[model samples]
Target: MATLDHILRPLPLLFIIFVISSLHVLPASATSSDKLKTATTIRKVNRKGPYVGLVTVIETEEDAFLASVEFRPDPNHPFIDLSGRRFRIGKIHGKKVMYVRCGRGMVNAAAATQQMIDVFDVKGIVHFGIAGNINNSMSIGDVSIPNQITNAGLWDWLNPDKAEGSDNEAYLDIGNYNVPQSDGNNNMLGSLRYGHEQLYSVNGHISSPQNVFWINTTQEWLHLAADLEKMELLQCVNASLCLPEKPKLVVGLKAATANIFVDNAVYRDFLYDTFEVSSSDMESSAVAMTCVSNGYPVIVIRGLSDLAGAQTGTNAIRKFGSLAAANTARAVLEFIKKLPSNYNVNS
Candidate 1:
């Protein structure tokens, strides 16, 4: 017969074995094998040059940028359509770059951003466009290089009649929006709101269920953009049309992105009060999220085209969109020249 001490000693070893068997841990070799497969897949793609990818949310923005700088198309491969989106390989300011259009809405923007990154050896990304101004201090045509950004589109819409059930944390109650449907009889509800899109990484780069709230711009790039604070912006759409105030460059604030175009004062106020965001756009946060996830650096430059919903009359984006686009392009060009000739993409 075994002694009591001997039986207890063996129990510890047996317990360790049981725990090890019960855990869903992948074998070390499996992780290594998966990494190898990923690397191989990337290598098989025949990706293009390591270039700084340029993106704009709409065609108007692209037109303005093209007018501001020369983007000579690569002779060998000028452009390609990948997943119903066009990617143009080119050189801007004598530096290799690829341009892609981030169509309206978050889905389009995310798809285009990831497509560019996957199809090309993207070193870094620079996204520029026009947006609605939320900060009262900023005027139309003012360029904003926000230090932080997030997708405020994510929500936990709740039924007004029911008690809140989920244990998840939420911010802001955007209720009283009993808007009648355009065709349907039911009214649209705006009950609750939350920030931060949640995701899990398969590559084990990030912890499981990462709550992405504010995606901070690359510190170095933001610092470089800060140097442009003194840069002058166009105050006039033309000789006949000029903004009441001279536009200026604003830096180090926050911006919000969503699929919905916000042209309501109530919603604009809510965004500013809740997120402290200076500007709102349809695409920036999606691009930022994609680049950050891919282990690359990215920054956004936006020119205020309208006062969201606080304007005295109709939206000013259409009237001043061209001016705002041109101003944003100017800022991007200046920012590009500030980049070091040889930069570590990872850095």
Candidate 2:
């Protein structure tokens, strides 16, 4: 005669009980569409083991990983071999790890993530990349740590004229629009729909007024959430399913953004005046979304890389980018160092 609230008191252990008991409790008698509409809290689990530290850096050059490698020294490194095309393995913080270059796209990022989890045995991933700023509050060197990431570009392609799918097929629902599902996996292909709590927990200014000014409103700035905010997070979240045993995973890091052309005054001015975007580059949103859904912790540390309307802000870009990345990396390392060798956080 336990109430739902009483029964749910120990929710953290639910995942283990569900798995051990092999219970396939259907979605509360609701249809898949209904389930989609409903929000779900991702379960988190932390187990005891030799604490390992990991950091992922998204850089233009292959050598970026090497730079990070020097920071953490491990001779017997764990490697991720992507066949002949990409073979990378290393150790950081004296723990096993892998470094990969997820070529710029959702599919590639998804594939690489899967390989890392499945093959390399990475507990958590830190996606380091760059992203653009759309809020005037941002300066040439500021960092954005987003609490939630929505697929901004997900809904722009609903051409009724081009609707060509089997009548029986269900279109992928990405918030407002439905897109064709190219990936068979549910986690990787669909649009992000974070729970209200998670969305509200995020701190920053998004174009969506609903998601703006949730927690810790330190700075004042506004940025428009664009349509194509990169489709990589879903892929990372999906990759979690592939793990034989789901672990409490964390996806963390920062990103900087600017105009498409690193050095285009016209584009910069357009972004600043119209979008009120601070800086522009690429990648943090994807990383943030993936981390949240996978039931892993994430923290974004960004630095402003460009001015509102500078023709080319490479100088500012490099300085800020490096500063942000360094600080983020240090923070991540510090967090890892704090974890005890016998730390056990229930998932």
Which candidate has the highest lDDT of all?
1
Clashes of each: 0, 29
Against the unseen true structure, what C-alpha lDDT does each candidate score?
0.76, 0.36
The whole-model C-alpha lDDT of candidate 1 against the native structure comes to 0.76
Local accuracy of candidate 2 as per-residue lDDT tens digits, 144-261: 4443343322222333333434431123333323245334333333432212223322333453324321122111111211111221111011333221221111222212231133
Candidate 1 structure, TM-score to reference:
0.78
lDDT of 1 by residue, 1-347 (tens): 53334323323343334333433465564453443333333333224456788888888898998776466787766775544577777676666677888789888888888767654677889999999999998889999999899888887776645455555435444444445423221433536647467644343445766777888778889988898999988988879999988889988999999888889998898889878999999999888888777767899999999999998889998999999999999998888878887732221
By summed lDDT, the worst window of 10 consecutive residues in model 2 runs over: 217-226
TM-score, one value per model: 0.78, 0.43
